[model samples]
Target: MNLNNIHNVYFIGIGGIGMSALARYFYVNKKHVVGYDKTQTNITNGLIDLGIEVHFEDSIKNIDSKFLNSNNTLVVYTPAVPNTHSELNFFLSKGFYVLKRSQVLGLITENTFCLAVAGTHGKTTTTSILGHLMNECNVPVTAFLGGISENYNSNLILNGTDVSVVEADEFDRSFLTLSPDLACITSMDADHLDIYGDASELEKSFKDFSKKIKPNGKLFVKNGLPLTGITYGIEDDSDYSIHNIKIENGTYIFDVKTPKTVLENLQFNLPGRHNLSNALIALAMAVQYGCPHRQLAKALASYKGVKRRFTYHIKTQNLVFIDDYAHHPEEINAVYQAVREMYPNKKVLAIFQPHLYSRTKDFADDFAISLAQFDELLLLDIYPARELPIDGVTSEWLLNKVNNKNKRLVSKDELLLEIHKTSANVILTIGAGDIGEEVKHIKKELSIAS
Candidate 1:
């Protein structure tokens, strides 16, 4: 269906990171945007500030009558929303043109020069960086990111519409919705097992995503992943590689060698080798799309990173505090590596909240091993994003598997007191859930304690 024909947009689960970006997009483009969220959040508040009505209640009566018309109304919903959601069921009952957020994203990109970033991890940072580069280069672009960019302070970056940048989410096999003109799979690590049920199945889904790229379009994959594509890695023999790496004053100074040229002294402060690989894929794709090499490097230096993705709230000579959205074992390992690299010899404390109970149960051993890498580990109860808690899949259950002697379960209320007890100098909060809401409190307490 042509988006131009839709006059009103209604969203279910409007508070979600990806959903809110679409809500903002249609709102800015002059559509009457309104929706329902399970709760009020900073994101929903921002949308309300933009004059889009959002209600926390799940009643059908909350939807504006303007969006009740099936002919002109476009109903969008996230998979995270329960199938029994009242507003959603009501729309379905009335025979409205309801669509999955992913389907709508595909429709939006169907005619545009779309560049999609897909992965179990790194998609947010990579997509955000790519969008920033294209925007700085004055390319006509609109990026729908998975996380709020620190530079733009928003997840939706609307520079123009000729180019569309999107996070091709793997959950629910959502990436398959896009027909990307150029795409990259940063890592196809098994994820959302609750959806895919097995690692091989997840990999097959990624391969299917690769097939969705336009016939003439380019595909980039991180080195060692199973799929075929232009590969990228650090100090490796990939099509695009990073070399001459150094860290100065907490920033990365490196050079990138693409198929066409070597761009030297490219500075980035995103704080991980994994992130450098992410930036490299973004750089290679942008260069392939005709962005000048110098412009890409210049934009890389100014990239402030996405919020909650290795975001530092307090950094000083005496102590350091960082927060990240590293919910998976591989992602947690990368965070640990980066933190250790950044602050060698300093005691690093990690506080992690497992995002889903099913994921926790599936990767409990792996999670235990990764969490053990920190100087100290504090595990919180699993944050059940969508799934019901599996029997025996709890923080204490995972904490027992941790080989670290300095590990303990933590409660949100007593968390401040517990942190003060630990003598760790570098404190990191890692998760993909409501643990973010506690960051401000943690930061304030740390500032006073330090």
Candidate 2:
């Protein structure tokens, strides 16, 4: 599909992080952009601020007349949208140039020198870091991030189009559509079991994605992953490794050992070893792409990080509040480790909102074990983003499995009250669903109490 020929671009689920990024990309490219989302959100508000029309309702009448012309309009829909979505069905019935968000991403990056980051975890952070590095080094690049970058305060980094940076998402095997010139896999954990049905199939998908790399192109893998390529890890013997790691004033000061030479005194402010590893792979990919190590180091240090990856809403010596998008068990463990490593002495109270019914049922034991690490826990009901509720899979069931004695299930209405009763100094609101919407209120209430 020639994007130049399409004058109008419409998004069916415009509030999603990935979809909004694409919307921004088209808007910047001078296309007439409009979209429909089920609800108004900060993302939709930001899009509206850019003069791109956005409506919340799914009615056909909500769509502007200009976008009804199939010849000049291209329709993009996310898989998360229901099959019964009226706008999506209308576009399909009209036989407009309809494409999945991933398909459109693949088409956009096909001609460019693409750098894609693929993994169950760390895709957003790794892609954001790489995008920042390439953009800082003055590479003519356009980056479509899966999350909003704090440095740019936007998901689409619009520098130039010669090189494209994107998160090669693996949901529904979406990354298969992207053929990247340079690619990296940060992890291959057993996730999205509802999609792949088992762990082995998920691993197979990553292997398939590795093959999608262009001929003679490079692939970077986390050192222990079951893939043959340049490997990166922290404080270990790998193709690209970080050593001399230490924290000073909450920022990491480490030296990266690449195949060529050691890049010393590199600074990254993001907490957690996972984020440090993310920075390492981004650095390794940038080094292989011929970006000067000196410039890359500066960019890595300058990166503020992707929003909700490990965002600190309130940080003080007396009280600390952090919000993160860690729905999977492995992600939860990473968050736990980071919190413990940073605040070893403080008592942490974790409030978690499980994301999906299938995921909760599939990894209930693992989630319980991960959540048990906290001193206290407040469990919320499943968000049920795409799936219907599964019988016998509930927050109370998961809470019972947790070994921690100080755990209880709470509703959103009771969340603030439960939080007030906790004696823990460190407060964490964790999940990937509408739990994020509570961050502002949580921060405000906690700030006043502190």
Candidate 3:
């Protein structure tokens, strides 16, 4: 278990966001890093460009020979990989030291001052904000984020080695492995039912994560999230809250009132009240970590935000396009609020691709209500990332429950053509699936037509 003894690091699912971050970290540290993924992506290509060996096939032969030795090679894998993967089995049967992505994160941050952000939503944005705050304050911090940060243009932010920031994911109970010096739970909504089976079980898992904070550490929670922690919210009686909020030129400008300080005129370019809350939580954590109030305030104002989380693809007087990863019903509602608040007079069109079949079946009614907020809607067939189809849970069934008359179901192939025919002033592509793979094409088409 002594990491210093290992010379080669190999990943089973290296193209995944978190796993790629880890691979990049080892590569930067001058270790031999190689990985196997089922497919290639922009992320994997970036890693390859950095001289990290990456192969698409799952065969054991693709693994570098240096990593074949059990004593010197360390294996890491994502939970999404199947048990029967060829390369994974080779390492396992040969007695390589294997670790889950979460376990490796836990091991790396154990000796540092860790700031962990846990929630069903908002974890990536909040963690990215916290990392920016620390970096701006000249703190020696490293952050492993779930999404590519627009500010840093990378998921791994390496400032120094003394402190660390991480998104404490709740899926597969991964957050349980982290013991944070300071932790926050942004929201505890029911999600990932395929893993927990019910909302109460999900809440119980979060409570356990809250208890994992160090004895001397602090815990921040949304004001009324049914948890006992130092509270945070917007314009409410919490330890920290955003007050005097205003929007200028489509940006959020606000003041944060912490327990002992009222930081003034903190500006953020990201949209939605939910994002404002995310910024406030990050600000509070920075202050608690001894970052100067003025430093944290400046960092908040300068943050560009995480990509695909309310990302603006086009913004002209004649047209506006946004892409967001809002898979859950509550997340979609937040996206709806941000779009309507920003352009109340415009005719908004929402194009959503449901992520998972089980999730679509579990929250069909809520999804219908949230998607109905748009002036027009286009529902694509469920992306079905990890699940097979469920009977009677098609996009057509969900479309019928929507209140909007302008709604229609379309396949990914017909999406651009249908979009070309619509008279949309504001365009929003909302989903957590591979629909994001279509954002650039949609943006290019709309940009040229307009």
Residue-level lDDT tens digits of model 3 in 1-450: 777788999998899999999998888888899999887888999999999999898787787668768998899999889888988888899999999999999998999999999999999999999999999999999999999999999999999989999999999999999999999999999999999999999999999999999999989999889889889999988889889999999888888887786888888888899998898899889999999987777788899988889999999999999999999999999998888888889999999999898898889899988998889999999987767789998999999999999999999999999999899899999998888899999998997898
Q: What is the C-alpha RMSD of each candidate to the true structure, in Å?
A: 0.8, 0.9, 1.0
On a 0 to 100 scale, what is the lDDT of residue 22 in model 3?
A: 94
TM-score of each: 0.99, 0.99, 0.98
User: What is candidate 1's lDDT per residue for 293-386, written digit by digit as tens?
Assistant: 8888889999999999999999998789999999999999999889888888899999999999988998999998899888898888899988
lDDT against the true structure, per candidate, is: 0.92, 0.93, 0.91
In model 3, the Cα lDDT at residue 6 comes to: 80
Best by lDDT: 2
Error of 2 at 195 (Å): 1.0
Clash totals in order: 0, 0, 0
lDDT of 1 at 188: 79
1 or 2, which is superior by lDDT?
A: 2
Q: Clashes in candidate 3: how many? A: 0
Q: Which ranges of candidate 1 are over 4 A from the true structure?
A: none
Q: For model 1, what is the alpha-carbon lDDT of residue 433?
A: 91
Candidate 2 residue lDDT tens string, 1-450:
788899999999999999999999999889999999988999999999999999988899987789878998999999999999998999999989999999999999999999999999999999999999999999999999988899999998989999999999999999999999999999998999999999999999999999999998999999889999989998999999999999999999999998989999999999999999999998988888899888998899899998998999988888889999999999999999999989999999999999999999999999999999999999999999989989999999999999998999999999999999999989999999999999999988887887
- Scored against the true structure, residue 429 in model 1 reaches a CA lDDT of 96
